[model samples]
Target: MTTEPSQLKFILSSVLLITCGQFHYTFLFRAI
Candidate 1:
């Protein structure tokens, strides 16, 4: 499989967003 730099960046950003969302959700659940 061939991947470009932009594609790698997009993947990394999406993964970061998902991880941040999970952390935020966990914090909210604990605070509630």
Candidate 2:
């Protein structure tokens, strides 16, 4: 099965979103 460019973009965006969310939570915890 060949991976399409759109699929790769989706995966990368999802990973970035998760990373951002984790960082956001960490920052909130530190602030509190």
Candidates' C-alpha lDDT: 1.00, 0.99
lDDT of 1 by residue, 1-32 (tens): 99999999999999999999999999999999
Best by TM-score: 2
- Model 1, 29: alpha-carbon shift in Å? 0.3
Candidate 2, overall lDDT?
Answer: 0.99
Model 2: ten consecutive residues of lowest lDDT: 1-10
What is the TM-score of each predicted model, taking all chains together?
0.89, 0.91
Clashes of each: 0, 0
> Looking at model 1, which ten-residue stretch has the lowest summed lDDT?
1-10
